[model samples]
Target: MVVLRTGPVAVGGVTLGNHLILAAGVLGTTGASLSRMLARGAGGVVTKSIGPEPKNGHAGPCVAVLDNGILNAMGLPNPSQDFTGELGSLGQKPVIVSIFGGTPEEFAEVAGWFKGTAAGFELNLSCPHAEGYGAAIGVDPVLVEACTRAVSTLGMPTWVKLTPNVTDITAIGKAAERGGATAIVAINTVKAMRISTALRRPVLGNRYGGLSGDAIFPVAVRCVYELFESCKIPIIGCGGVSTADKVVEMMMAGAQAVEIGSAVQRDIGIFETITNELYAKKGIEPGEIVGCAHE
Candidate 1:
């Protein structure tokens, strides 16, 4: 048996066995896949960012792997918060409902949909190619703060997901804190572009997309570190984390937990492998390692 040394971490009143969490991706856009991931041993799961109602999103070939990370312009395609109540019936694992809205009131409405479900809410104010409500709200500290505070009154953990494209990430990180966020998911995808020599145009149909993967590690680390020094709430470090060492690095930067985004491209078992490897090497239970590096 693999003795995993993950580490104890708490978010919104729930104790996580380990710090490893799967970031929101295409999985939860559908109910079936979301059900499968919860069964696969993921400590916590973030649903793909959803809007108040249905959104068709941008066109695909949505994801393109670059030399470093992956660029995607999925445009926050989701079934909206209407189906969120059903999430509470999924299973035992904590469910964090990721949401996007055009206004503070709209965000509150979407968040309220989880009144009887979801352990928390992740405010996705940062998606590069997502139309209208994506990166716009995140670029403004006041807007981010307003939205965070609006949903926070629900008595559930509210996390503001920040965008790295900004020159100063700490500003927004602090703003999220001021608005009473339980946590902040640092460094959402950076705006990026790729050109195809054959096509002589942008590779992604959306022209620009959010970048994620190993390429984003340095930036994500800096943002996490900055927030650690500036804010008191727990931080969920995400972006470009593919190995156990990177996971440890994020912890040192003051992240209470780490979310693996593009690493899923490696394999579904990649998370299990990394957690098992950390466990084998440290000879500690997964819960014992959560934010050890930072402490």
Candidate 2:
């Protein structure tokens, strides 16, 4: 694959090859996969969310494809500390480890395991379907701050992923900032569900899942816009971001960088494609457009 360059971007204290990052859980399960994304075009890659223990994730039918997006209740399946071995060949590529846990101590312990190997840590405080974790603890401002503090204290570039399921996303963004986060990732998947008309039951095994992809792009932009107004920290925008136009729009809404997930399922070369288009249409650096809409 030809290396597509759109100039480097610095977010959450780390320099990226470009502004396009592979969101957590999209081909992020293995070190080889994460490295592959970077090799293909992503400026950075976030490993799938890891917890305190190994998990099998949700049962069958955990993912349901939609016309506009994807709904999944994978339950945060991960190998925990055992996954560390896969990082051996990743080299110095910008690999951000995505982690989650039930408490501050748990979150800190999980981050501690890979502090030496990862370029940074993206706290997965926004997984909506997982029980006793993710949105379960993420919705509260107090816990969000505590969890962020627990991991931020580790001295790594800490980026906190926020849930859009909340009443006020800026509140959580502020909490993450108050906890000393290096940056804040806005707008995780929206909480949603689908009933199988033919099967006469819920499509997802968990009866609920997080909705991601084009459907949530507007919501993600709104959240980023709000965070940019309310917080002083850099914001990494996620949710429904796919095209180069969308990336530009997101940055205009206040995101310094953008993460793409579900869109990759359709085209694995999305990062390179987007970067090419981005530079083709807009010759200037991405930073110049950050929050341009606000002006």
Candidate 3:
């Protein structure tokens, strides 16, 4: 059996059971859904990436699946902070608020709100489909550093989620490290789109969307490995993980924890299914798969 190896994995002073983490997903968009994930045994929860203010985001048909990944153009539509405040008191599970903004100051302000409440903060530095700020911040090392530093003063673990569209993911990875990020979430969705040839338009309403799914697993793994090779910090892997086997693969690639983005919609009980499999395979504990690659 794959017994989960035990170790201390602390983020901003909160110790998680093991490295088995559920990545941020749609469930995180609402406080009710977040509470349920905790009930289902997720180590912690990352809110759906939010912007500084309420955003209408893109219209429906925002998400599409590609051969290897999923494409999403959801405009980061989120209930405003005032409406989401109840999230702070919803459950005991550590909450790592994910926020996006057009400038460093805006991100810092968002970080400021989470002080004394959220367990950590993950800056959505990369979101392929969002306009201006999403992928733009991640492609430039200087901007990445500036944005990270701006939010560093929040006195919590700040993780910069990177984009895969860059030429060298490691460059921005290291830049974030230099800017004082506590850890790195190795990748946001990759940009890809499906088009409607008959309509002479993109399949998604936004004309383009991010691609994420089983097909992107290899790409996610490679990006995680490359970031691990370049920097020494806990890495949060997200993308195309729908089973315990994929979870193990991510651990071997050096992810301290993994996120379950689009997979939440794959099956309502998928988390329990995968968690049971991990335990059945002797991976009940978190960080247990740290050295799985060498074995």
Better of 1 and 2 by lDDT: 2
**Which wins on lDDT, candidate 2 or candidate 3?**
2
Give the RMSD in angstroms, all C-alphas superposed, for model 1: 2.8
For residues 1-295, write the lDDT of model 2, one tens digit per residue: 1122357789998889888999999999898899889988999999999999999999979999999999999999999999888888997889999999999999999999998889999999899999999999889999999999999998999999999998998889899999999999987889999998899999999999999999999999999999999999999999999998888888899998999999999999999888777764337656668898999
lDDT of 2 at 290: 88
lDDT of 2 at 160: 94
Cα lDDT, all candidates: 0.79, 0.91, 0.77
Q: Estimate each model's TM-score.
A: 0.91, 0.97, 0.91
- lDDT (10s digit) by residue, model 3, range 1-295: 3545444467534555444455654677777777787778676778887767888888878876655556778878876576457575664567778888888999988878767777778889888877777897789999999999999876788888999999999999999999889889877888888888898888899887777888788889999988888887778888888887887788888887788767776677777777676653433565556546645
Q: Ten residues in a row with the worst lDDT in model 3?
A: 11-20
Candidate closest to the true structure, highest TM-score: 2
State which candidate has the highest lDDT: 2
Q: Identify the runs in model 1 with alpha carbons over 4 angstroms from their true place.
A: 1-8, 85-88, 280-295
- Rank all candidate structures by their TM-score, best first, as comma-separated numbers: 2, 1, 3
Pairs with backbone N, CA or C atoms under 3 Å apart (clashes), candidate 2: 213-240
